[model samples]
Target: MREVPIRENSIRLGQLLKLADVVQNGSDVKELLASGEVLVNSEVELRRGRQLVRGDRVRVGVEELLVS
Candidate 1:
């Protein structure tokens, strides 16, 4: 598990993916997200625009990232 700091109130899921270095770009995120490989707080999340705030947990493959 790793902590990814957010400097604002919240960030969109796709943006977070990029910020966290989970994906290379928006297109990568879209394809990855569409493949149902992303999880938010342990649940599958398919929306790129999903709002994520501090304390939220995101999992991509074996990587677990916590919003801080």
Candidate 2:
């Protein structure tokens, strides 16, 4: 289990991508997100602008990221 802290309760989808190391650049977040490779709470997430809050778990490949 890995944890990433959001400076504010409101974090953008692109920000979460970089924090999760799914993409090296924030600019590529949208592409990665559109690939339907990102999962939130075990469900496929396709929205790059999706809002995330605490207790949301994002999973990519074998990585499980916990937000709090």
Q: lDDT winner among the candidates?
A: 1
Q: Pick the candidate with the highest TM-score.
A: 1
Candidate 2 per-residue lDDT, tens place, 1-68, comes to 79889889777667887877768996687777777888988899988778889899888778888888
Q: Please provide, for model 1 over 1-68, each residue's C-alpha lDDT reduced to its tens digit, 9 standing for 90 to 100.
A: 99999999999999999998988899999899999889999999999999999999999999999999
User: What is the RMSD of candidate 2?
Assistant: 1.4
- Candidates in order have lDDT scores of 0.94, 0.82
Taking all chains together, each candidate's TM-score versus the true structure is 0.96, 0.83
Task: Report the poorest 10 consecutive residues by lDDT, candidate 1.
Answer: 15-24
Candidate 1 deviant stretches above 4 angstroms? none
